[model samples]
Target: MTAAVPTVSDAEAAVILARCDELARHSSLTDGIERTYLSAEHAAVNYRVAGWMTAAGLTTWQDAAGNQCARLSGSTRGLPALMLGSHLDTVRAAGRYDGILGVLVAIAVAGRIAASGRPLPFALEIAAFGDEEGTRFGTTLLGSRAVAGTWLESWWDLRDAGGVSLREAFLAFGLDPAKVGDAARAPQELLGYLEAHIEQGPVLEEEGRALGVVTGIAGARRFLLTVTGSAGHSGTPWPRRRDALAGAAEGITTIERIARAEGLTATVGHLRVFPDAVNVIPGKVEFSLDLRAPDDADRDRGWTLIESALTDICGTRGLDLASTQVHEAAAVACSPRLRAAIATGIRSTEPTTAPADAARPDEGGSDSGPEAPADDAPRELPSIAGHDAMAIAAITDVGMLFVRCAGGISHHPDESVTAADVALAVDALEAAVRALAADYPAL
Candidate 1:
């Protein structure tokens, strides 16, 4: 016989949705950075979230560095706790569901557990991380890294576009930079973590799936390229003068071609021309390139090609070239045990369908062979973008479940998801949390 479908009340789902809307309405984008970590807005939304946590029976508190926490004590108090949460902030012009879903769902899960009056095997702690987007400071995973004891003090000296240091930003938000170390927690105390999020990609929608089981976080390398050449009159013949803009254009095309040839992804998202005048040939051009891949070897190979192409293009164009690494993050793998739990939970919710396939498999091994039976359930895919869970996964076991977003659009006013998708994800999450907390042996 099929197992019963895990259900979440409409009221609970509505509450979670409402919280998402309310948080989005606030202008929490950090000043100057303006993409994430708005001080005033973070304060406003976090306060409301803290109040909600208390009402839901959690003992809520804010850490020295401003991470908000809500604790629900389990019968096994001395045991390591289960963490369920996501960041409260957003990228500049971010959508409501990106990070907010994880936080609100944790609240909903904790609330449901309390109302059910069932004793849990381990403690549950819901977290609303301070700033995962790094929209203000150009550094992502600010909160989770601190908790993981991997945060660097030099990060405090890094400045945003506005010239304000992270230390100063923390002070502006009433957090002490000197006390950042206080945020660290013993690794043993964190049993496991789970984050619910929007897929932020087209994989799920293209496959007609409701949810995705994430396997690993993609590695990213970002750089700023500056191409310098002599400026000249726009009226001058193209062959007579060295033009930086022309060289930059060639570099951009080369990057695209190399990334495609290597089967990696690269983007020239931002560009600027010196003087930016219509009449000038342009003395200098600056652009930003972001490259990403699933593993280090692939990423390194792609970057090697990128540099070679840039060097050759600059030499042929007689333009000076300079590049600097702006950001780099190594890929992180999810725990096998937690991944199995998520798959089991999803399959349990819709037993008629086969379990979603793992996005990544062991080396030299296939998760499913060519003749493997097809499942009625949709397949899960890996995420190219970064999220708070990536940071948490560095120090503790963490897993992620992604609900389908409409049209795969996110980080904009037009981003959205359906209520039905939300309901399904929440149901799966509730089951997963219960099963993980129940001490079921690893699959």
Candidate 2:
């Protein structure tokens, strides 16, 4: 009868590294980080994360899609919460723990569950979001797609790169772009979402472990394409040149050989071209793409073999393709009872032993009982970038917990992590919120 070691102190790992160096001193690059979305360093990191969510006792606020919320209460008062969070916006020379160390490790695991007075049956919010690195409106999960009600009134005519617009940066950040649909909420006011973040890749330091268990989140698409043709005089003669950046460099190497024959994850990042004369020849071009998979029918079958190899590489170079699909999303998964409570919070962070094919049979359900998932098995993975839990997994049961960063190097400033792997990611997200309140209790 000994299972109970989820710790995390050291003054809660120096109050989550001094609140991630006090939100990287409200950035916008005084020579480093940037912090975007409704700017002014996103309102001084949401007024210092609502004063560290009211000194961690919680009950804060700031939502209407600018996110930064808080709360607490459980075992009573209007339950249904268990949210936790991430995203505090950043991206230009960013990385003081991408998305502020998952909202300061969910307010240091809700201040270690309100100093263990133990009552949790649900309520525990948190958030912090403010636009997951859309970096001032490129449109990534704008504050988790307005709390998953999926906001998109044409993304208020998205613009910024200085052209302004996301409704004049929400009325110059004072907010009220028609109350951003009051930041939608409703999946019965939630009782799922988790988060934690920072594995930014290298699979928990190549499985030497420090938490892991996302198995879902990659379902992107993006596109743009373009191509066109007929410009000339790069000594125009090669059959009257129809270049369009050489048919968009052979359609970006056949979109990297059909996303490397379906193991998926394409990219291209960006391009452009037009007639920028290096003696001309190119006519248009454009580019972009992106892709990504881990399902959604293999990211719509690799965008149908990258739109049939960019329509046979722009119809044998007479070039004229167009495209568009600016973004898609979809795949999310993670709830076989929260991937068995994030694989029982990465086996409560250590002490291992069972793996001769670790008791099979329970497929993805992982036999959700005593927080089941340890016979040395839990290392899920997936997430090929993009989060705000893919727009709060369209309103509920999300789950994630990564951790190990160092060489996965996320969005710049040498993206690191360690304070003993964020005190084992706040004791594996407080043992995945007490293994989902012992597998969903309190009716």
* Top candidate when judged by TM-score against the true structure: 1
lDDT of 1 at 345: 65
Local error of candidate 2 at residue 156 (angstroms) = 15
lDDT of 2 at 334: 75
lDDT of 2 by residue, 153-203 (tens): 988988988798888888887888888878889998897888888878876
Which pairs of residues collide in candidate 1?
35-92
Clashes of each: 1, 0
* lDDT comparing candidate 2 with the true structure: 0.79
lDDT per residue as tens, model 1, 78-168: 6667889888877776677778888888888788787778967778888889888887787788888887788987797988778988888
Q: Residue 256 of candidate 1: its Cα lDDT?
A: 93
Q: Let me know the TM-score candidate 2 reaches against the reference structure.
A: 0.36
